[model samples]
Target chain A: MKLTILFGGASFEHEISIVSAITLKEKLAGFDLKFVFCDSDHTFYLIEPAKMKAVTFSKGAYKKMPLLTLAQGSFVQKSMFSKIQHNNIVLNLIHGADGEDGTIAALFDFYSVKYIGPRVDACIFSYDKRYTKYLCEAIGVKYVKYEIIHKNEHCNITIPYPFIVKPASLGSSIGVSVVKDESELDYALDVAFEFDDTLIVEPFLEGVKEYNLAGYYANGTMHYSIVEEPKKEEFLDFEKKYMDFSRSEQVLQADVSEELTLRLKTNFEKVYQGLFEGALIRCDFFVFNNEVLLNEINPIPGSMANYLFEDFTASLEELASSLPHSKRPKVTYDYIHSISQAKGK
Target chain B: MKLTILFGGASFEHEISIVSAITLKEKLAGFDLKFVFCDSDHTFYLIEPAKMKAVTFSKGAYKKMPLLTLAQGSFVQKSMFSKIQHNNIVLNLIHGADGEDGTIAALFDFYSVKYIGPRVDACIFSYDKRYTKYLCEAIGVKYVKYEIIHKNEHCNITIPYPFIVKPASLGSSIGVSVVKDESELDYALDVAFEFDDTLIVEPFLEGVKEYNLAGYYANGTMHYSIVEEPKKEEFLDFEKKYMDFSRSEQVLQADVSEELTLRLKTNFEKVYQGLFEGALIRCDFFVFNNEVLLNEINPIPGSMANYLFEDFTASLEELASSLPHSKRPKVTYDYIHSISQAKGK
Candidate 1:
């Protein structure tokens, strides 16, 4: 089996994907790995494994190689003879537009290639904050009150002051801002618009502790990890998350009563059943006064969310091996031909 | 400006798309058209213009020509080394999975090509019945009560008898069955499962008149056509819709009240605003006892839904010309490079 790690996409989260890729390579060391790099311009490359350690967006770290593209239902080298066929699975690591938002997955689906993670539709639904909010609302889950703003529409700030403004489809807090007052709304909107045409503004929770659980689907069953609370000053901003070295020091198992745990578990199950059943999802919730408000769901969570699970490498190996691998189903066009022949002279 | 008509697809609606393509060629006769045919097996062909008239699934009607594939960020003819560059817009006519469900459009997006339809994310949401239902629910719209069943889960028949069973993601009623009793449920489930892994079972709306309207986004504004009610013996099944030539006689402009028209317009605006704001959407509604219930939204309707509009050709021309045509934005990797340069030492 040819397992390819696809990382670095056309998104603001490009650098973060590199960090995640480095960690993934270390964790999945037992497997024979092939690497495919998607550049920020959406070009794909089949990288040399010997130079994998030096690959980066930095001036001299990367080397341009033969391009890889899907042509006539087969993945092939651009020079036109070499094919990357034979039982391959893509371990997707692209985080934004072409990655987590379903574009890459959809491309893979178009070619009938197996890619690890959510189906294309699920990724599209989960990546967009507005759609996620709508999904939560439809499932009767409580979420932070938010207003969806389209790019061409005039700014309407119906939600009161001290709200968080975010691009609807970005990950890793790329274009997120905590707006303190009405005066700060336009600036926040501008920042978010740079990332995506759609934006979501939600009333900021003042003193709520953020609890998150990472879960995966294995052999038709959903397995969830123990909840952890990230101790941050406010929200985890981009700088504090990636640049600051002291970020993961205080990720403690969330302290809650058994009744609360039961409620959380039940809600998590409902969410998974309703929306993110096939892929590994990292769900974040705000808990204050025993009320849990669903914040967001990440379809391709960071580091494939390994840290959340005990025996992370072993569990991932099991999940990876269990993927239903097969060649693209040979579509029986016979039915179509039969119908056409019966109808047309 | 070069305009291409992309038709047929790797979907159950492949034949329907061919029919649509023939009609679209007549409807869009004024434009200089390039033709691309997607076979049922998902291979793309750049057919010679003179040979496009013979393109069909009928025995010996279709001819496979130069293979068109996206390479180095542009659509190209693989054998001839010819580039399909310079001011090209795809009038997408693919009706189902690889077409309307966003996979092909996402591929176009990946290559930064312009296509005349909804954006990829919008198409993904609108094509899937389950997601459309969830979006309607989130927006407080009245929809048929439905239960989603995933593959590998225990089959639960919670919806009352005389319900509709449908594959969650297929279009044109490909895998839809109206079950009148419990005995017919298993066969319906089997039929639905053959199409998709996810299924939606909804309580059937009895004694309801089905009204449909075609609309599109033009010049940043949504344009809607008058509602047309199809006089069907029962629900419009796949055979009656396509195989029966007498299907077009009974489509009448709905004899609705002024108040009903206003309500329909309002609801249509809300639905478009809340969900689809990109391409043309054909909305189906059930009207009975002065109540309106959304049935489903078709992202890529047949003949691009020209018959529903008053000045069909004029309206379609306007919408096509008003598409937001721009090159794919060049991504700036300077920030990523700067971060890598600072940290990767």
Candidate 2:
């Protein structure tokens, strides 16, 4: 099967996607891998997998990677490799914006390409932090108190102090800041506005422990991985970038109480079912005083959430094999189509 | 200016969109018009404007429309026209699903093409009836009482006996049924399920008058068209489709009381600003017992809502000219880029 690994998107988390793609390539070695590198400007580049892997985070090494463009639905390079080839499945590892935010997924759908990820509507639904909060509230899930601030609006801290400010649509905590006091509020708002016109300000959950659960849906049932807790400071400040972020800080099968774990898992499944489809997603939660509050829903998490599941390679192989049968829910307007045709006639 | 009128999308409302494009083409005659016809299969075709207008909704005429495929960044025909050309602007007239639901908007964004419509997040937020209700609830806008019914769940009628069952994401009146009692529940559910996995049941607003307000955003302010009330039966049933629906039944600048008109305009502006950014949108409302309630938000309404405005052609000309300046809010994460680069080094 021809499996295309798509990475490097027009998102702030571009490097993270590249890292995730590298990890996926190594894990899914059994399949024929094709690489599609999406530039920050949204241009498609068909990169050589070996050359893409060899890049050592240096400007010179990046320049040497083979790049190709799409011509008639095929990935094409001008000189030697002049033809384009279609993929049986596109394992999209591109994080944020064009990739995880439904742009690329929609493009794949336009080409009738089978890709492993959530549908366009699902991706767009959860892309905004404000929308996610509304979804959580609708599902009766406990969430932190929040307020949406528009860029043109005056700076009035209606919510209490010591709250975190975030760009509404960004992922991987790119433009996020914890306003410790009134003095830091202005700077935080300024920083947040630089990333998005719409900002979400939520009160900092005191004594909150961050826990993540990765899950996927297959054959009409939801499956989940063991929950992992990331040992971090009270707040994940914007200054503490995600690039240098290490998985070593996470405690696999976290030593949380059984009751709390059960609640987290249950809520995770509920959110996954409500807001997502097709993709393997990671749901982050804040556990405090026996309450599980959903922090974020990562539709395309770092590494496609390969680290969370046990036997990542086996799980991926199973997922890839099931891609042909794992269909996304599509609306069939058979009645409407006929009605429309009759009206046209 | 080079303007491409995109229509006939992969949606239940495909025929309506073609009608809308035909109107747009006639209204905006001053601009250089190019028609990009998107079939139900998502294949794009470049049809001559005169040929497109000549077609009387006939299957033979549609079959003869020039079909084209994308080659790199350009639309290409197989023989005689193999090169690609870019349009200065894309007037997206496609309604529902891949069109109005944000799929094509995201695709246009991916290709850095400026198109007339709301962005992905806003479209998805309003596309889902349940989410739109939540947003209205959050913003303190009065709305009809509704209950969400997920697939695989037992058929439970929580709302009142006289209620409407509708697919959450569909536009127009497709897969929508008015259930007056228990006997009609199963048939309504079956019809609704044919369109989507999730369905919404809302109480049938008794003695409600349907009013619609179409508007667009320009230079940081929302502009409006005349309010029109469609004269229809109590329920806009599936049998009474929108295609055969007549605009002649509508009372232009509806003669509602001044107080009611004020409320409608105010609510319209609030919903427009809160829920949408770009494009001319039509907000549907139900006025019952002096209470104004939001019914639906049509991101890409039929005829581009040309009939609502007093000077339809002038509005199109002005809107088309201002497309370059009428920008959507975007995030600029300057800090994250530098941080990512430094971390990579």
Candidate 3:
């Protein structure tokens, strides 16, 4: 079966996506593969699968791939991509903004292409922190209390001295700042306006424990790996995230205490569903005052979260080995068509 | 300024969109026009704005139209849409699924293109019924207790009889069915699944008074319109919606009581910001036992809700006059350079 890989979107996490895609492609290279990379310039290229490990776009037209656009699920190049046919499995390695969120999935749905990951609704629900909190409340999943502030509006109401500010719909910790007082609000707001109009002001959970989860949800049941405690602050600042890993205190794999692990795993699954009635998700949670409150859910976690799962000794390939060996069921258009007929009937 | 008349989409409401677009184009013909149409096959054409009124295709070469891909929002054929230069307004006329939701809005946001209606986050929140109910709850608006059923998941228990099941993310009451007994649950599930995999089951309010809202949130306050009563039995259906005049038993405008109208107007504006944070929205409410409970929020209401706002004496053109004026105040980024800087910085 033909499979296409889409990576490196117009998000702050674009380069890291290149690393993740190269890692995933290297793992899956023995199979028949067509590698496609999406760049920041709103275009895509079909590169040689072997060249994914190193830079090939050094010179010549093939080096710098022509721009590709998505019409539904199929990718269209104005000149080059228009000539290539679509693949059966379109693995999305794109992250942040349109890639990590449901926007890309919506295009996939439009093309009637079978893709790997969560549905559009769930993908969208998790990308934005505003709706993510609203949903967490509905499903009874514990999460931080946050107020969404629109820049066009004004409010000076203080939520204590320290609070985490984020551009509501962004990921990879872009434009996220931990504000200490009223004096810093303007700078934070200006930084936020660069990414999104809506801002999520969340009460900082002080002196809390934080953990990361890589989860798999297929056929309605949610599965996850052992939670890992990050050696970072409750909120990872942009500098700590990318430029300076030393800024983060340290990351330690917590002991899988039976009771605590069970509770954390259960809540992680519920939070996953809350974000979007999705098929797969990766969740982050903070444990404060003996309570595990969800932080965020990543629907299109990098290269299907190979790092988090493998680090926990639950490798994706191992999971793939144990699973029932069957191709992903071909989506049925008849199911969608019958409803159209029902409208007339 | 140049304008792109974006119409047609891959939604169940595709045909209805065609009808709406043709009507909108006929009325808006006096403006500079770029008629870009999306066919059922998902092919897009950019014709002479005037000639796009009817469904006409030229000799097999995708004539007079650019093969434009909606994702990332750029045209494949520059000559076809080169007429649509920078910073032009896009009068979005599509509805249902991705079109009605914020997926397209996010794309519009990526390129800094301003369109008519709410931002991506608000549009997405309003689309999901489950989330909309929570928005109502947050703003102190009432709602019936509702539970969701997963696709193909067995009936754990027939939700108490006399309940209504609807596809969670739809408008125009397309897949709504009132089930009175356990026997009807399967049929209802079968019907609802035709539209969506996730289904919402709410105990029906047998005698609730229904009210429809058509208002824009200019400066975060909603203007009023006399509510209209539908001429249908127990529940509103699709047939009554698209062709109401002939099928209705009785259709009349309801008089808003003085004290309650004042309360509703205040609360309506309150809820517009609280429940649906958008520039414009159409909400549905059910008043049970003299208490109004928000049932749903429509981010992109059909035909821009022309008929509901008709009695107010504002011509459709006047309703649309606000399109060009809405601007997304944002910072200009040297995007390519930013990609390089974002990676390094």
Top candidate by TM-score: 1
Worst 10 residues of 2 chain B by lDDT: B324-333
> What are the runs in model 2 whose C-alpha is more than 4 Å off?
A54-82, A237-251, A321-345, B29-31, B53-57, B60-65, B69-86, B237-251, B321-345
Pairs that collide in candidate 1 are none
Q: Rank the candidates by DockQ, best first.
A: 1, 2, 3
Per-residue alpha-carbon lDDT of model 2 for B1-345, expressed as tens digits? 567888877676666666667766766677788988877656677877787652433353555656765533455566564555655577778778777677777777766677777777668767888878887877777888888898889867777789999999887888898899889989999989987889999888777888989887766566788888876776665445454322322236888787887888899888877557557888999988878999988887876777788876666556655553322233244444575577693
Model 2 residue A31 distance off true place after TM-score fit, in angstroms: 4.1
Residues B7-81 of candidate 3 have per-residue lDDT tens digits of: 666666654554555555554445566766665565667766546533342123335455654433444344533
- The DockQ value obtained for model 1 is 0.45
Q: Write the per-residue lDDT of candidate 3 for residues A1-345, one digit (tens) a residue.
A: 355777766666665566556666655655466777655555567777767742342122344655555544466556633454555467666767557666566556656655665555676567778767767787888888878788778855458869988888777788888889889988988998788778888887778777777776544356665567766655666544543211212234576577878888888767665343333466878889988888898776655655455342233333333222211112223422444467663
How displaced is residue A187 in candidate 2, in Å? Answer: 2.1
Give candidate 1's error at residue A27 in angstroms.
3.1
- Chain B TM-scores, listed for every candidate in order, come to 0.88, 0.86, 0.77
**Superposing all C-alpha atoms, what RMSD in Å does each candidate have to the true structure?**
3.5, 4.0, 6.3
Q: Give the range of the ten consecutive residues with the poorest summed lDDT in model 1 chain B.
A: B243-252
